[model samples]
Structure formats: structure tokens, C-alpha cells
Target: MVIGPDGCGFDMRSPSEMEADDARREADEAAHAPRMAVTSRIRRVAQPPDGYLPLSLFDEVRLADPVPLYAFEDVPADVTGLAVDYLSRVARGVPARDAFRVPLAGARLVGRSADAERLLAMVDGFSDRSVRAACLLCGFDAASRRGPARWRAGRVIDPGPATVYNVRRMVARTLRFMDRVGPVVWEGFTFDGGYTDRVTSGDGDLLTADGLWDLKVSRWPPNPTYTLQLLVYWRLGLHSTHPEYLRVRRLGLYNARSDTMWSVPAARIGADAVRAVERDVIGYADGL
Candidate 1:
């Protein structure tokens, strides 16, 4: 018998049908290719609002502060280091909770040393690599003790009894110095409110109605770099759209260890200096 079109062994499609199937597949691929191109273009154009400014651009900019410089003479190395660390915390407005969270070897040394001399001898004998660590531990320990009796009162978390009394003793002296200096409004004042994207941010230890103050807990005297740092802050403030920007009319540094404060007139940090810094920053950014 002759095979019918619906027979089980028959070829279902003709050559024309096969050609039409190939044409449809090619058309589908062509239709999708444009979509893929458009998607790629969108991705290429998408970018952050601030665009791509290198970090170096922000670093290159320097500002000026009119504050006078101070010289610290004949301060003990250990005392200076301790004072710098303590005052730096205070200046940054670091909460007692946060400061106490920092791990210190002094915490372990607590109740371990029988006397000050023994503790000193132990610390003195520490390897060069361990000396800084020991000092930091001692500083933290002393600060923790003094926190309860002073400004950080009720904030000191008990790491344990004091094993190093001398560290606490040194901390007490530093606290007294802080107390004698009296209170300033800008302690821990941060200038991040108006920071533009891709720009550097800064903070001052103290902010007054008329000026901004940076705290330096250092044995060394103020230098141009410090002044420039303050100057940059001033420029950032001046350029800021924030209402409080105008309030910062002065710049200065407070040497916590030396108990000295130096303030410069805001006017002294001129537009020229700001422009110069901006130029340098832009040049650097371009190079990158």
C-alpha cells in the first residue's frame, strides 16, 4: 500500500519548512543583538555623582592657618608620648567606652607588678619592638584609672587593679594639665558636615564660636604641615555651604602636654593660599 502523509515512518517537514526555521532563528538573534548593545552602553555611561577623582587629588591640596607656632623644649620622651596619646583621645572626642575598648598590655600587667621600680625595670628591659607596645599598654591602663576620677569618670571599664602605678601617676598629671587648661567648646569638633564626595575630611579638637582649634599632644613644636592642615580645614569650611562654616573665623592648636594654645586669625589664611592649594591638588589629580 502507498504511504500516507500521516504515516508513522514519514518525514514530517519539507525542505521549505526547514529553511523557514533557519530564517526565524537568525531573525531572533539579530533582534537580541541591539538590546545587548544598548545594555552595554547604559553600563558604560553609569557613574557616581562625584565622578572619578583619585584619592591623591584630595591629598595634594593644602590650606593655611594664621596661628603662631609653639616650641616644646626639654620634655621627657616617655612623658611626651603618654601626653600625646591621652590628649589625642580627648581631642578627638573619643568616648570612654570606645577608648577603653582598645586592647592594652597594661590591662594584663595590672596587679602583676609589686612596685613601681620593678614595673619600670620590666618595661625598660622590653625588646625594642615591644617597647612601644608596653608604653601604649601603660598609657591605656593609667587613662582607665584616671577616667573614674576625672572627665572620663564612670566611663572607665575596670580591666583590673593597677599593677603599674607609675602609668596611672603620669596619667593623673596629664589629666591635671587638661583640667588647668579649662574647657573649650570645640573639643572633638568634626568638620565632616560639608565634606564633598572625593574630597578630604578633617576634624578639630576644639571649635569655638569664632575659630577652629586642633589639639596636638606632642613633644615637638608646631610646623608648616600642621599649619597647612588647619589651613585646609579653613578652606573646606569657607567653601562649604553649611551655615556654621562662617562661624569658624580662627584657627589654632592646643598643646595638651605643654598647656599652650596658639590661635591664628582666619583672615590670615587667604584666598590665594586656598587657590594655590587647590591648584596643586588639581594638578596632582590630573597627573593621576
Candidate 2:
């Protein structure tokens, strides 16, 4: 039973309708609210990393785009990224099956969760086979809300062989890197709206023993947008009630596709730059 969006009660709108809706939403929020995600404020703030940091971390930029370790025939980067992230959590200490409960619950709510569970049961451990299953599961989870309505119906999802092939390879590279890192002090942690109510919620990937880290499973290099997002996450951590972030002294990015890492010391990010983001980008009130 392939469920269409209609079957799942998801609102189906044409591109124009969606665009108009977005325009209206933006217009309504324009006066009182700022952009919510850290990504939104990056270019708008116009605060380049060079404006804030003394040294460039990605100085030895790979001129050549990295050759993929495995062929991703049909899998999107989003599903692959989630699979790698989930596998990383499993590599640390999270139970493999349990980690997917929330996403799976969405399927369960619509009586489709059993199919995913049965499919996942074929793999017993964190093998390449398991990676493939995780990828499919992530795909199904992504599709549940975002995909066409028919996809949401009681359908058995096949994340495709390419997802298993590519994500397995990516996870192998990522695990090797993750093993060398310190213990995870934080995982998928979100922040309080300390600076602005308009920007309500955001989360960081990992705060390991060494520093704060963001995982990038994409083909792109670390641009200014990526750099600013990390900076925002770190600053948000400091502003939040969590005192543990005070001990974090570095920001890092791990590119799973290229098996590479880039980082900058938190100390290099000047206080004035951070203050500017708070005041300008994130809309912090004076003396707050």
C-alpha cells in the first residue's frame, strides 16, 4: 500500500502555492521574527570567517573534488548523511535499533512501522549490510513527510543498493576518524533562545572531548556559510544554560566523503566578532 501524501494527510501544494505560502509566512514574520536557523543568518550577517579569525583552517584546500569511495546510484546525500550520523552514534554507545525509534514512530503511527522493523531485522550488527538497512530506514523516514503521498502509504522502502554501498564506505571512513576522537560530551544537543526569541531552536552535532564538531557528508568544501554555522553553534552553546560548553575550546568539521577534517581554535574567533553576531545577526538586545 503505497500511501500518497493525501493518504497520510500531508498537505499537497503546487510549487507556486508553496512559494506563495513561504512568501506570506516570511512577510508575516518579517517584522517580529528573524531567520530561525543559523544557516539563514550567515550571508545576511556578512561576517566572514576572515573577519573574525586570524588563520585559515582550510588553507590546503583540495583543488580536486574528492572521488567518491562508493557509487551512490540513487541515494540522496541527506539519507546518507543521516545513516553515517546514526552509525556514528552506534559506534559510540547508542543502541542501533533504538536510535531510530522517533522516526520509526512516524511510520508506526500510520501502521507502516512494522515493515521497516521487519526489513531492519535482516541485519544483526553494524556491518556493511546494516549500514545499507540504516540508509533505507533513513530514506523511509525522510520520505514519510517530505516525499509524495503514495510513498507514505504502506509501502516497503528500498533505499537502493547504492545507498548501502556508498553509506557503508562513508561510515567506514567516518568510523576510523571517530575512533581517534575523544568521548562524546554532547550529541544532537539543541540550544535555548538566549539571544533572540525570533530565532528559537537550533542544535549542534557533537561536542567531543577535543572540541565541538559538525559532520559534513557532502561533496562541497568548507565555505563561509559552514564556518559561520559552527561559530553560531559554539556561541549559542556558551549563551545557553549548559555550562559544559564553556570548556569547549575548538570547532571542527569532518567531511565523511573526503575522509578529511578542518578546525579552528575557539580562541581565534574574536570576542568582538561574536558580539557582532549577537547584536546584528541574531538580534541580541543591548545589555542582554
Candidate 3:
């Protein structure tokens, strides 16, 4: 069940209460918008450490990529999630099972929102039980779905106990990869801060002293959209929040499946390219 802000129990708001809550949240956000913008501007003017570019160049930048698997991997992973659904069909060469079972493998590979959070906590020296708890939660969530069995894309199939065992193995591999990478300043950091007033806000999987890294659980190198995502995070971090904490020199994508890392200097993401990304993203959002 969905938890509420107080965490005393599950969310149980009535329709009217939910609407009122939404309205209040919007109002509070509107009230804070000006202050946030001013803070962002002040941060931009501050000089970065040696070898780092100023944040001003990215103020007008926007992301051009669509909300596909490669582009939005920072979102919670699920078996039936967009990324897993695509991977199951194209990469895994496995016929799709019911929607509920689709996310079992992908969630283990990439992780769901709770899984990411728990992993971050684990890296911070929290108990290993957090990882096990996350795995169990995912499995429980999958098994709890109450719907008639349905085929995916006209493919009829069933995921058996072996599938569950495979998910556990994948989780162990993922955890091992994280251990190799070591600790970071932040993980699963969403630059948005739950406010959508500006274009800079987005997700950055990990933040380090030198750069922002996006974790990829894919076999291939990250695509252009993934590169663009790092650029966006760098831009957002530069202009907003603790600028000193975000004085990153580069952007990186870590391929967890391959245990490989790829990075480039942040300065190489030119203004012209950012402008193009901005145009495309704005245009797409407008169309939507």
C-alpha cells in the first residue's frame, strides 16, 4: 500500500482531501519559486574550482530525449516498466509473460525506487538487510498483483521459480558492482526537489566530487540520450543547490552489466548542442 507523509499508516485520503492537498502543494511551490530562482542565479555566478566550466552556459539548456528506457533509467525499474518491457522483447529474447511478472527480472537488474534508496543507504554503512528487504519487497509486490492472467504482445508464457532464482542472482551481481564502485556524495538524487518550475531539475543516479554518474545495467555503451542526461544534471547542479558540492569536472555513465565506466569533460558539452536539446525538448513537451 502507498504510504502517506506521516508514515503512520497507508495513504487513505478521500477524493476531496487529495485535491486539497494537491492545491496546497501547488500554492507552496508557487510561493517558493522566486526564492529558488534567485538562489539558482547566485549559485551560477559563483566560480567553480579550477578546470570546471561556469553554470551560466546551461541556463537555457533542455533535454531532447524522449522518455524511453535509455533516457529515463533513473526512474524506478519494474518488470512491466518501459525499459524491462523493451529489453524482454529485444535484448533478452524471452517471450513476455503476464504484466505483473514482466518487471521481476528488470527490477533485479536495474532496481526499483525503493531498491535504489536502500542501496544508497547500504553504501552509507547501513545494514545489509536493507538489500535483502528491497529484494523481498519487489518480489512481494510482483506476487501481490490481483488480476486475471494476461498475455503480453500476444505472447503466452509463465515465469517459474527458476525466474525468481535468476532475479536473485542478478541482484547479487548488481550489489557486487556497487561494492566495486565504492561510496559517493549522493545516490538516487533527483535534482527537481519535487518542483517543476524550471528546466534544470532532473535525476542524477550518483553525484561525486568530480562528476555526476548515471548507472546503466545494459550490455552496450550508453546512447546519446544518456550522455545528454548527464549534461542536464551537470547543468542543473551547477546553477542550483550547493554549487560547491556540485563543482563537477565531468559526466560519467557506469555500465553495471559490463562493469565499465565512460566519462567526458563537462566543458565538451557545448552551448550549441545544449540549445538544440532545449528546442527539441520544449517542442516535444508543447506537442504533448
Cα TM-score per model: 0.40, 0.69, 0.41
lDDT of 1 by residue, 201-248 (tens): 334445556666565545565555556556556655555565565777
> Which residue pairs overlap in candidate 3's backbone?
78-103, 79-102, 79-103, 80-103
- How far out, in Å, is residue 236 in model 2? 0.9
Q: How many backbone clashes can be found in candidate 3?
A: 4
Candidate 1, 129: how far from true, in Å? 22
How much does each candidate deviate from the true structure in C-alpha RMSD? 18.7, 13.2, 17.7
Worst ten in a row by lDDT for model 1: 53-62
Q: Residues 1-288, candidate 3, lDDT per residue (tens digit)?
A: 476788767757798998999999987885675332312322433222411233332322112222222232222344312222222222222222322233343344444545434432332111234323333333333322211132122121223343333333333443444444444566545554322344423334566656676666554555545555565555555544555335677667665335456767766666655554333332112211
Top candidate by lDDT? 2
How much lDDT does each candidate structure score?
0.42, 0.66, 0.42
Model 2 root mean square deviation, Cα atoms: 13.2
**Candidate 1 structure, TM-score to reference:** 0.40
- Model 3, which residues run further than 4 Å from truth? 1-183, 192-202, 278-288
Relative to the true structure, candidate 2 reaches a TM of 0.69
